[model samples]
Target: MTAPVLEMRSIVKTFPGVRALSDVSLTVAPGEVHAICGENGAGKSTLMKVLSGVHPYGSYEGEILFEGSPCAFRDIRASEAQGIVIIHQELALIPYLSIAENIFLGNEHATRGFINWNDTLRHAASLLKRVGLDEHPQTRVADIGVGKQQLVEIAKALAKRVKLLILDEPTAALNDGDSAQLLRLIGELKEQGITSIIISHKLNEIAEVADSVTILRDGRTIETLDVKAGSTTEDRIIRGMVGRDLDHRFPERTPYEGDPGAHPALEVRDWTVHHPIDQQRKVVDGVSVQVRRGEIVGIAGLMGAGRTELAMSVFGRSYGRNISGTVLKDGREIGTRTVPEAVAHGIAYVTEDRKQYGLNLIDTIGRNITLSALSKVARRGVVDEHEETRVAESYRGSMNIKAPTVFEQVGRLSGGNQQKVVLSKWIFAGPDVLILDEPTRGIDVGAKYEIYTVIDRLAAEGKAVIFISSELPELLGMCDRVYTMAAGRLTGEIPRAEATQEVLMRHMTKNTR
Candidate 1:
């Protein structure tokens, strides 16, 4: 029998007032794709962090063995020195730097205290080619799309001569084509005798590429299953992570009564938004959409299809330039030219990039939750701290935000919990129309169901919801009606009964110039 490449035994890591990991163990064989499956806050990422020395040696109690040798790494650089490279969920490349520069930022091609540009670009070009990224090494990283950025991240890892490559939510920001290319690259790397440990919530991707699967729940190792033995089904893995079989992926919603056209809760007409920098380029071309009271409408499209642009433009002219749109609420025109006006007009938008645009990372959960509507918790023009706490506590309970207290920092919470806080903030604002953009992105299956349930409940409460997602099944499962977009144009609209992956793909790829 071949010896294991990596082994982590009895790892325990903790934060203030929270135990992130507890006596968790993982084993990875040489040249095998190992997958770590878990729900949000399950310590999947924490375990990898410990292995990569992000937590250091003394910060966590654990025994790590690499290539049958006991290892004690103090920092990320120490781990990288031993051919262990970790690509975090958030890509670490600097946007302003060139691709080659970003790839070898810290590990530069230098000789005798002098940098070698020739060797750097040459090696970066080769690495980019190996990763199937067809781009000039000197190209500015900011100019490229997210899919390319992901490739750049991999190329960066490969530059380190990585033996045990660790990727956390690598495909979270990628579209289908990009995701497929990434997975194929992983397979190629496996063939080359490189071991990989991938941590992701996308179970299909896990089932597709993983050789062995380790399940973690609430800071403990549940079990590890061998994929080749036909034991790692998506549902089975989900059951292990969530500790129960999820009978339904999405919550059932009561059908909206009456003709949807009879009472349009929110409507956008002749909406066209130009690119922010490139004024002549229209990101969101002449498009119009309507949502009725008590209806959950969905926008399904590929990356760069302008779904987010459309929603942002409609919400508060948040994106794009040269915007021309008329927003109507209950047959009355409303001014949504600014964020404050949009909110006052009963329109709330939950952004896809929660860490970036959704929440104040340094602030408390209570503060972030009540940020959108402070007036409700204010008295005599003074912010009432007790009322704010009460309101935030109410949302924390209803939204299922898993935090010890409302005083916990928002950044300290998991992706799903942070998302719930974002939802809570907007819902507290008491909006008649809510726009949820990739609300469940990077979240686990269990959290997704909760988010879906919240959306359904909002629709039931007579709130019009415009749900935008890149996942076709999510759209088909939770949406009452799904609209497809391509090239900034509405391609097709399919009702729940008529929607399928095949049909949605057809419309999503439709050339609607």
Candidate 2:
């Protein structure tokens, strides 16, 4: 029998007040796609960090064996020297740098004291071609879409002669077409005798590509299943990761039953927004939407279908240029020309890119939660820290933001917890209308259910909700009515009972004038 490619024995990792992982063991075979399935805070990322030497050797208790040889890596450089490379959830490429520069960064080809640009670009071009990326090596990283940037990241790993590749949420930000391409590339890599370990929340993608899956819950190994052996299923994986059988992925709620004649809680009519850079190109063109009180409306579309642009533009004109729109609340026209005005008018937008536009990562969770509504806790131009703590504590409990205290920095929390913090912030603002953009983008299935429940609760309390997501199933499960967008136009609107992946796809791909 062939020996295993990697083995980790009795690994235990701990923080100041929390034991993140306990007695975890993992084994991976050569030239196989291995998947690590776990909920947020279950130590999946921590284990990968330990293996890649992000936490170094002495900081954790573990034994790592790579190709039957015991390994002690003091840093990521040492791991990379052994043909091990990890691509994090966030791409590390500099936006302004050329693709070739980003690909060979820190590992540039040089002849003794002199740098070699010719060899660098030549090698980068070959690597990009190998990964199915057709762009020129000199193209700036910012010029390409997110999907291509992911390919560049893989090309960077290839530049290191990587034998074992680790990807964290590789497809979280990619569209369906891009995700399919990346998965195909992974299969091609397997055919080339390269091993891969992927940490992903997308179970369907795992079922499609993984040869073996290891499940973890609360920092311990639950079980490992062989995919070809007919022992692995999405439900079984969910059961292991969450420590319970998630019979229902979404919370149940009553459908909207508002009167047709009554005005919607929020309405946008003849909304048009042009691209910020391309002055003449329209990003959102004459789109209209209405959300009745206590209703959850969803906008479904492809990657660049203008769903996000429409939401951002409607929310105090945060995005786009040459914007022309009329927003109405309770049948009366309201101005949303700025963020403060939008908030004052009881409108809140939870952005998709949480790290960039939502939370202050360096600040405490308490501060981030109360950032939007400081006046509620302040008096006579004087801020009260004690009252702020009390309010944050209340939200921390209500939102189930798993943390030791509200004083902890927001950056230290998991993706799921960070999302909860963003939600808590908007909820504290007491908005009558909420626009949530990809609220569960990189979170686990268990966390998704919690977020759905929060949305349901908000709708139940008579708040109009506009949910925008790329996943069709989420729209069908949560939204009362779904609108499809194509080429900056509203293609179709389907009631929840009539919505399906097939029907949504047709509308999403429809052509417009």
Candidate 3:
């Protein structure tokens, strides 16, 4: 009925040797919650970048009509000036700064360039309240949980007087409770007449709150459906995303058939690790785990239940201090005191934070894939570029990484492809044991199935896998055996036949001496 709030007419964006977006069009109504769904590399992020001016005006060919006026934004600042703010999946808040300080970091409350702290905190308190966060304004951002940090990010957007807010994978890292809270907040924001365009792989969330759904597939807009019209279900969205019906969320995995009495590929005994900063707090306490050859073992726990801490600490003591652990390979104690030693001991860890810990974003895909095992391609003291190229190319083909070439920058790849690159790096290292933490966190259903296929292949090749995931269904689907962790202790170990959400939850929350 009313004129659309935003409209993009025939948008096209391209990178070297790659057409990221091709003649994409979008329309968003005023004060409506719109959802953008796509498989990785589907040009969803590129379209958003075009609108937010991250791609800028001259970099792409498009006509952007905002509130019935054709406008060209030269940069992100220009878009923000027109009350459009985009929040990335990776939050942009300074950890060490106070919440108030972070909210008003760039746009400060000041008189003649001198910041007025009293006014800043007073205003920040109101914004925090508006977002339903009860924390004090002076509380350090690092001290709070990730959900609160997300709220702080929104408060920062409000500081700029944002009218249109764009969130990319807003709940990718949040737990169930936090995700529910954030969704509720979105509903509240909608009631306040702030339009939101959410880009997420979580279809359930989209179905729950979206007024309209737009699906993209391989650099093109497939279709847009009105969610209130009762035909835009999650399955419908998936079909549009992948161009086919996905009957199952995960690939069918055959039961693992391996010698149970044989020594495990990797084992940890009585592992204990103190917090990196607080030595008195035991982040991982006397935990033991084992993974047999040709088997996928899972670790399940709540957000603060020490699943990630245990995995990181055991992987070359990478996470904690005052660590005491006994690591064994094939029934013999092996020294994994450092990262290099861990790799040498036939162990690899694909970190959960792929951007921060896994891949080198600025480097070429060829370089990133070969980085973990450079010695394999190195001749004498110098690296053989030819050998490196061959290895990277082989992995690029095997992993099905959607890039123009191996020379493409890894940062340019989509979330799923970037994950594939991270996996390729570790697989090239020839590890006997692989620790995958949240391997499919933000990827789509189709991409998730592909990753699951990769994991199955690794197990079939006789490599042990320690899979850690927040989703209980993932654990039940992929793991041959699942171990439950609670308060840094192992509570229960359930086989695939016996593992259920109810059983896992009981163990995940139980207290053990």
Clashes of each: 0, 0, 0
Candidate 2 vs 3: which has more lDDT: 2
Candidate 1 segments whose C-alpha is farther than 4 A from its true place: 259-261
How would you encode candidate 2's per-residue C-alpha lDDT over 416-500 as one tens digit per residue?
A: 9999999999999999999999999999999899999999999999999999999999999999999999989999999988989
Name model 3 segments beyond 4 Å from true: none
lDDT for model 1: 0.92
- What digit string (tens of lDDT, one per residue) describes model 3 on residues 51-156? 9999999999879999888879999989998999999999999999999999998799999989999999999999999999999999999999999899999999
lDDT of 3: 0.93
lDDT of 2 at 125: 93
**For model 2, the run of ten residues with the poorest summed lDDT:** 106-115
lDDT of 2: 0.95
How much does each candidate deviate from the true structure in C-alpha RMSD? 1.0, 0.9, 1.2
Candidate 3's displacement at residue 385, Å, is 0.6
Candidate 1 lDDT by residue in tens digits, 18-100:
99999999999999999998999999888998999998999998799999999899999999999999999999989999999
C-alpha RMSD (angstroms) for model 1: 1.0
- List candidate 2 segments past 4 Å from native: none
So what's the TM-score on candidate 1? 0.98
From the highest TM-score down, the ranking of the candidates is 2, 1, 3
